[model samples]
Target chain A: MPLTPNDVARLADLARIELSDEELAGLTGQLDLILESVQVVASSVPPETTPTSHALSLTNVFRPDEVRPSLPVEDVLAMAPAVEDDRFRVPRILEEAA
Target chain B: MSEPIFASAADLARDLAAGTLSSEEATRACLERIESSDGDVHAFLHVRADEALSDARAIDQRRASGEALGPLAGVPIAVKDAFCTTGSPTTCGSRMLEGWVPPYDATVVRRLKEAGLVILGKTNMDEFAMGSSTENSAFGPTRNPWDLTRIPGGSGGGSAACLAAFEAPLAVGSDTGGSIRQPASVTGTVGVKPTYGGVSRYGLVAMASSLDQPGPCARTVLDAALLHAVMAGHDPSDSTSIDAPVPDVVAAARAGDVAGMRIGVVTELSGEGYAPGVEQRFQEAVAALAAAGAEIVEVSCPHFSLALPAYYLIMPSEVSSNLARFDAMRYGLRVGDDGSHSAEQVMRLSRGAGFGAEVKRRVILGTYALSSGYYDAYYGSAQKARTLIIEDFDRAFATVDVLVSPSTPTTAFPLGERTNDPMAMYQADLCTIPSNMAGNSSASFPAGLAPEDGLPVGFQVMAPPLCDDRLYRVGAALERVLTERWGAPLLDALAGRDRLSEGGRA
Candidate 1:
């Protein structure tokens, strides 16, 4: 099924990317072409075939709960776009709560 | 310009060890080359001449004090900007993380420093390693050194271009799909994608976590092997890292022998879609291996044709999930932070503004595919297709020691050729995606110039996981044969042009 501009706009919202109407229109066509090419995957493989999420068969890779040196707080905070009082300063999450 | 500027990493290492050359001198030569050529090449995103000299001088001092050092110590190497470095910015060719200096080094970068290799600077790449052509890079495309009008194949284009342009003797590139090998092919440099989990992925800004593998790029197979040895092996920090010894790639590279080895020609990866010049050179390479006493047989991997469609689904799915960390709450570019806009609005605006078109396209595609209704039809089926591709490799490797194909369908296409067409751009990696899908070891060697375009073609070799040595063996053998046939290394043609420009009075 060819994706419409509405589908791309919905997807952009789900992906947390604010796209303009122009971008949504352009993406709809390009993405439709790409989806058309890749849609063969549905028919190409047998349904009974098991999916391989990872190339290797590794599972439940766990390490001992040991204390390790971590990056310093100041160093970590220095890279933040906005920081205040040793915390990452983000835009207000809830306007009423704020 | 001096001879050492274009010397192989192996030769430079030997000279440094023999006390005939100082690390400072070699570092300076590379820095000077970058200064002179990188303006046109645009291979580097960042260059740290002062830090590189300091590191080289430290290595020189250690050598003078009779202290032991690794083989690659004091060798100047360019790193792809995707790898996080403490001092240098790790942009990954995206405005998202522009000028963002990483708090720590990537495992590969840490290893490079541990080996005493001088870090010259970070090279450009596709934003978050998304596009096949470096044209998607926000910084700008890295021009092909051979022909400035053409693209140097990407996301590792800068790393490959630096080697081709003699800016750096060795470079490190992360290959998701054909990022490293394709760029290497077009620029006439050597690149390897080691077996998945063979190299630690820690600190490598995730593109597709399952497929991304960092490897070495160099002028020669042995130099790639040497750098590979320094970079590969298990790291506890990366849970996916394989707890196994690195294959003896250096010995295999030096062996350069395909004698009595059974080599397979992947039937699906060639013909139709493949350019005539690329097919011609690949067939000649197969013949050369046959002449070297290797038994050649055609192996049909039917499912290989489905690799491209499957990769587009799987890679984008992973990309969507992986790139979600770029929320405006933390590091990287944040937009719409004015009091009126909420945090969510800021995240939406930042991601929309920071990412390039290709990135946004894939993210949306992935979000659609992974959505409630389309999950099984798109992402799940693609995963199943991945299983079949692996099985095909298994069946092929059972009979043959290694598989060979044209690394790309054609030589480097002109810049802006496929910028408007994502499908055409994705076709550049048709022959290369199967290896990544299977997590096998693959490398691209110079397969002489394409007869029509006079541009470089890459001969790709694939080996089963942990059997990465076989790739070096095949690459070295072909490099030897092709170099002999061409009467010199393939890059000599590019260097000859450079000499002309240098010798000519303006």
Candidate 2:
């Protein structure tokens, strides 16, 4: 199926990255081309082949049940864009009852 | 120009340990070259001249006291920006992490320091290792040292260019898809992508977890192998690290005679899309290898045809998921924070402002592929294709020691030639992606300049997982032939052209 501008917009919303109207218009064409080229994957691969999530087959990896020293708290908070009381500060997530 | 910093890391180390050359002198030589030529090359995103000299002085003192050290001690090297260094900015060439300093060193960085290698600085890369050409770098693009008008190949372009321009003897590059080998191909340097779990990925900025592998870059195959041995080993910090011994790559490089060794030419990676000049160089390399007593055979990896499309889908899907960590609250740029807006709006605005065009394109494509209704069709099929690709490599390796091809379909294209066309940029890694998908050891060694355009061309060799030594053996064999034929290393031919670039600087 050919990609449409509406599809690109929905993708932006899903990815949580806002794209301007002009940017969406531009992405529509590029996405369509990319999708068209990549469609070959669907046709080329056999149905019985299993999906490989990782190149190597690694099983459950567990560590010893002991605490190891980690990054200092001050250093951890130093990288945050906004910090309050040594914790990350963000905009309000909930709204008052309306 | 004062004193060429182009010596191999092994030679530099031999001199440094033998008390013939001081580490301070070598670090100064590399720093001076960087100051003189890096203005136009843009190979370095950050240069720690003082820190590097201090480290070199410390090594010199240790050497003066008769202290034994690693073989590569005191050799100057460039670090790709994808690896975090405590003293230098690990920007990964994006506005998202602009001016952000890492709290600690990447495992590779820590290993290099422990080996007493001088850390010159961080090199430029495609933002978050997204694009093939360094042109995708948000800060700026690194021009090819061969021709400043052309690209240096990329994501690891800065690392390759540093070696090509004689600024650093060795460099560290992380390969996701073909960031390291493709760049090394066009720049006439050697690039190695060790077995996926062979090198620890503890501090490498995640691109694609299953695919990203940090490896060594250098002018000679032995130098790369030397650095490879030093940096590779099991690390308890990273769970995916292979808890086994690293192959004796240095010995393989030293004993680089490939007599009676079978080298297979990958049938699917050539002919149709390869430029005539590039193919000519590849065939010549094969012939030279055969003449050196290596048995040549044709191997068909039919599934390789789908690798690019599959890689496109899979890499972007991983890119989207891994990059979600850079939310506004924790680190990096945050926008639309007037308190009039909510966290959702700030995230949307910040991401839109932070990521570049190619990155945004991949993120959107990934979101679409992983979204509802299309997952089974797109992402699912791509993973299935990945499986087939890996199986294909396994089958081929069962018959031959290693496979060979032109590292890239064509040599370096001009800077803006493929920028508008995303598919074209993706094709830059066409010949190199299979190894990444299969988690094999792959590398590109300088084959000679293309006769028509006088640009460097690379011959790629790949070995099955953990047998990285074969890559070095094959590469060193071919490098020996090509060097003997040209009467010097391929970079020797670039000296005159580099001087030309230097002349145009002022």
Candidate 3:
């Protein structure tokens, strides 16, 4: 199925990225070509084949449950674009619970 | 200064310890080389000249005080920007984190530092190691040292270019879908992607978590092996790190004996798409190994052809998930942050402005794949294909000690050749991706120059996990044979011709 501009726009919204109309139009064709080419996987892989999440099947790695040093507040805050009161500050993220 | 710039990292280490070369002198030589030629190579995104010189002086003082230092003490090494440095900006070639300095060092960085290697600078790369060529760098593309008009393969292009241009004797790079090996291939350097989980990934800017690996880049096999030895120990900080003794790869490189070892040639990895000159050099390499008494056999990995398509899906899916952290919240560039705009709006605006076209393309594609209706069709199927590729590798490695192929299908093409063609650029990683998917140890060594274009071609060796020594063994043998035949390093032939007009080629 060919991707429409609306599809890309919805994806952009889900990804939290904004795109111009020109970029949206441009990406539609490119993504379509990419999908069409990679669609070979649908035919190539057998349904019963197990999916691999990683190259190695390592599971449940645990370090000692002891307290250790973490990054100091001063150093951590230095990397933040906006820091206030020893924490990261961002634009308003909440609406009233009403 | 001239002699120090072109010396191997191993030789530099020996000279530094013998008191024939001081760390300060060597560090100054590399900085001078960067100052003189980096304008043409565009290899470094950041050169820590003051920090490097001070670090070098400290090492010199330690040596002068009669204290024994590590083997690589005082050696200058370039680091890929993907790895964080505590005070230096780690851009990963993206405007998003243009000037973001991390609070701590990556495991590899800490290891190199403890080993007494001077941190020369952060080398440039494709944005978040996304594109196959360094052209995707937001700062600019890194030009190939051999032919300035051609591209330096990437996203580890800066690391490879540093070694090729003699800016640094050794460097570090992250490989996901052929970033390190492909760049090493075209630039005539050595790059190794150790077995998955072999090297810790504590602070590498995540491109694809599962496939991402940090490895060594150097001018010679043994130098890469020595650097690898320093960085490959298990780090308690990374959960996926393998808790096993690191393989003695330096010994293997020094041994350089491949007699009676069975090397397999993957039938699916070569043929129609391979440039004639690349194929010619690869076959000669195969013959050279045969002459060195390493038995060569042809093996067919039928699932290999579909590896590229599956990689595009899996890699982009991971890219989308990994890059989700870049939403203009705590760190990196923030755009349209007016008080009136909401958090989501600011995030959208920032990402829209900060990300490059290739990055945006992958994010959208990945989001599409992982979306509600399409999950099983694209992302799920690709993971299954990845499993098949691993099984194919298992079957092949069962019969052979290692697998061989041309690192890339062709030599470096002119810059802008594939700028608009994603598929063409994507194909550059074709031969190098299967090993990545399988999480095997793989490396690229300069095979020889391509006769037609007079550019470098790379020979690749893939070994089963934990058998990384085999890669060095074979690579070292080939390097020895090829060096003997050429009578010098391949880059020396193009010594004075590396520069081109600022407008591009002559």
Which candidate number maximizes DockQ?
Answer: 1
User: Please, what are the lDDT tens digits per residue for candidate 2 over residues A1-98?
Assistant: 67788988988888889899999999999999999999999997889999998888898788889987898878877778889998889976655342
Tens digit of lDDT per residue, candidate 3, span B1-506? 24898889889998998899999999999999899889998999999999999999999999999998999999999999999899899999999999999999999999999999999999989999998779999999999988888899999999999899889999999999999999999999999999999999999999999899999999999999999999998899888899999999999999999999999999998989999999999999999999999999999999998899999999999999999999888789998877877888989999999999999999999999888978999999999999999999999999999999999999999999999999999999999999889999999999998999888999999999999999999999999999999998777765545463343543
Candidate number with the higher DockQ (1 or 3)? 1
Clash count (model 3, backbone only)? 0
Residue B30 lDDT in model 2?
94
Error of 1 at B334 (Å): 1.0
Query: Which digits, one per residue and each the tens of the lDDT, describe model 1 over residues B302-345?
Result: 99989999999999999999999999787999998878888999
Residue ranges of candidate 1 with Cα displaced over 4 Å: B499-506
* Per-model DockQ: 0.89, 0.83, 0.83
TM-score of each: 0.98, 0.98, 0.98
The DockQ value obtained for model 2 is: 0.83
The TM-score of candidate 2 is 0.98
Clash pairs, candidate 2, are: none
Which docking class does model 1 fall in?
high
The iRMS of the candidates, in order, is 0.8, 1.0, 1.0
Complex DockQ, candidate 1? 0.89
